[model samples]
Target: MRTSRALASPAPSPQEIGRAATLALHDELALSPKPGLVTLTDRGSHADMDAHTFMRSLFALRSYFVRIAELGAAQAPFEALEACGIAAEARMLAATQGINTHRGAIFMLGLLCASAGSLAARGLRPTVDGLRHTLTQRWGEALARRALRPSALPGGQAASRLGLRSASAEAALAFPTLFETAVPALRAARSRGLASGPARLDTLFATMAVLDDCNLAHRGGLAGLRFAQGCARDFIAAGGAGRPDGLAAAAALGAEFVARNLSPGGAADTLAAACWLDRLG
Candidate 1:
């Protein structure tokens, strides 16, 4: 088993961070039957966005990760870092025509990029533990303050109404879901000798089963969130992608989610986070 520290190396360059972010987003897009998320074959549960829209959004925000990484390497203040996020969000909206394709990712992955930068600056290797440590050590308090601020996004509002953990709370805690659940799930599947696609599928299901995804609640309320979690839990319990019928079962779930108009964007974001961390190592 890999410890939190893992291996230490020099901080990654801005270009490295940018490449990792882009590939991570691509990995997420490539995963199929992600149960309520967009992919190459279909738009999952979303009607307004498609795979092409996600491609555009990814292209638009590709540079933001690099620039934010530079800021992190420079040790910029949290507000300045957030300003970059706001700009990136606007760019994403512009590309998707006001659609929220990657808002959750912009916050979660963007911070990880910045944290990687900070780690590089401090002469630490950009390992999983390093990124998490930099995020909490350097900006954890600021993230906590941001969590207290009200958000205008429906997901944030819905999370509050449902008494669920908001995205802000996840960031403030340096992403417990990513570190504690998503990453481990990915590693576990790989250790079991599963292929990349299967590993990622299992990882996504693991996150969905536990995460208090605001997007699900925003669209379907608490009932919606519970439904998504149950689906994910059942999938995992049924051997996930390891079973011969797993892919078929997941495809069925995807159809069901689209019909129900439920999307687990939060889980998708964490899945991407896991991809990013794996790539870094």
Candidate 2:
């Protein structure tokens, strides 16, 4: 699929990049019956956040993406780009009343947004491969250094405590999960003629099956993470969203996850990343 509606025009503006990113986020939040994650129809496994909270968070983050994209187009330093992320996190916190709604997205999708801007600056189309290449070629060293910096966030702390790879590590390596796993799964689903929503659910489950979700480990330890992975594997084994009972199977798995207090937040972030990349292509 083509990345843009108007490929004949010049590079996209910062506002255009930001709007695409925000809409991708909204689509992720709205995907219903997502196992062990928040969705428009229900809170899934989370009690502190709901669809409304996600909406508020998205509202607060609209301009942050644009500003970061502009910074990328200008070839700003990593610190300047990070500053935009910091401010965006503050806004997200304020909107969710300290609920930590979209912090992971702020990091992963924020970098992709910047990568898109960098592509535009070079007169390149914002294809998925282009975005990944721009991220590594333009900011690979900086991301490596950033990965070594100790994080104070709960997710970061949990990742360190458990010895799981940090999100920063993934970014430093150009997001193997997004590129190798989630995006491929999403494309496979769409290529099979699945609608956007079902395709996204399949992508989410595919991510959940493979991701070492720090959120699940944080909340339920290794056992919980394993259980989540097992459920995901079973869902996919049963044909994922392709089966007539696929959506129902997903909903049932979600109920089981909630009972165990297992929320695959990391997998959810990966789903959002896949959604963003899909929009780009």
Candidate 3:
């Protein structure tokens, strides 16, 4: 009798899941020419933070991801997960000396890591759909309630003022953008034989085109958000990153975003979540 291939490989350990989450964030950080976002080589729209600041924050949060995964594997309640996230955010702020480098990632990716852990604990192979299901089944109600509460964060405040979809709402919806838009865009680009760099560029633009990025609203208001969306649409219309001059065009867009101080941090987080899902496979 031959053993099944799925049985031959064990489910990823909690620690491994945590490490993958960290690397997924690094993937987002390394992707350059991201309109109004930070990269290893440039600070796209921020005057207070650079690559070094992000690096410190990443280093600080490494253990938090592992702990959150452990909690998820134990099937802990949403409050437990929220507590872990709150602690992680504090560490990140401390590491970056009060600069919020990975605040959004802490919430979005932290929940994702927890969902993956839940799947692994049940002897289930973590797929995109499995993770989403686990998240909704386990914590969707809590997330919905969270969406109803007032937020003190600048991005959340901006989203409220503009009547845009907040991060909490995205989580309550089980991250429709991450599963529906960003992941599909990434998978499609990769299947089309685009390199990692170009594939991510295409995915980023695809996400930016649709995400109600609160960071853009916070920085430059509704007009700025619309401007970023228009730029993203133009990029996608121009054949995306698959085109010969696609990367060049993306870099130029990044310059324009910086000039206007518009940053699509929400879209960046979604892209990182998609990357994490892809890596889980």
Candidate 4:
């Protein structure tokens, strides 16, 4: 992570912050060898959607982040942010012809961009701490109330069935996994001189090892989720993407995930959020 000194420059405009969020989603899509997830080259575990589907969704959502950010800059109530997100999700579904390419990103990265806007409006540059603080301070109670409602989304329903933490729960807690796990893993890998691809790969695997990915559970059930986590843990135990054969190992893992029809979409969303935060600095 960059120091606060590095972040002392003028805060980015809402449009710039929104653009970074879109690019971060693109970055996640362009990353190859993602276990059980869509990439530019292949549809990992999903047959319904591919990289093109994701691109169209991203294009549709280009303005949404900015709108949400503007609302956040004004310190608008949580209802306003939720309404923006609901509309964005509709646009994403329309763009992908009802395919859910970026639903998770819509919620997670949208909130982050809004937090960034909040900081900028307050004449502060975005730091991880600042972003988290803004999000919680501005809408923590609303998020908690939102979490109490039964989720209708497939992933959230699956999480409920399995007694796993839903995405809303993570949000209400201010996305501990994004700040505590994914961002740190990405930064540590980069600080160790790893390239972007390897660093992201490391972060993905690290995230998978711990995240109770509802997508995986929805597709493959509890057993499948455990299997995926075990694979990720083993990958990290073997030095993650730092080893010479790391890419090959990741490719093999991707193949295995496909065969089992498991997708760690939650972890992928977290990785994209981490990428967006990295860009903010």
User: Which number leads on lDDT?
Assistant: 4
lDDT of 2 by residue, 15-107 (tens): 888888898998888888887789888888889999999999999999998999989899888888898999999999999999998999999
Better of 2 and 4 by TM-score: 4
- Count the clashes in each prediction: 2, 0, 0, 0
| Model 3 steric clash pairs | none
Q: What are the per-residue Cα lDDT tens digits for candidate 4 across 30-148?
A: 99889889999899999999999999999999999999889889999999998999999999999999999988999999898889899999888788789888878999999999988
TM-score for all models, in order of appearance:
0.95, 0.95, 0.98, 0.97
Better of 1 and 2 by lDDT: 1
For 1-281, candidate 1 gives per-residue lDDT tens digits of 65455243545688898789989999999999788888998878777889999999999999999999999999999999999999999999999899988999999999999998888776665776777888888898999999999989899999888899999999998899999999999999999999999999999999999999999999999999999999999999999999999999999998899889998899999999899989987
**Candidate with the greatest TM-score versus the true structure:** 3
- Model 3: per-residue lDDT, tens digit, 40-130? 9999999999999999999999998899988989999999999999999999999998999999999999998899899889887678788
Residue 231 Cα positional deviation in candidate 2, in Å, after optimal superposition: 1.2
**Which model is ahead, 2 or 3, in terms of TM-score?**
3
The total of clashing pairs for model 1 equals 2
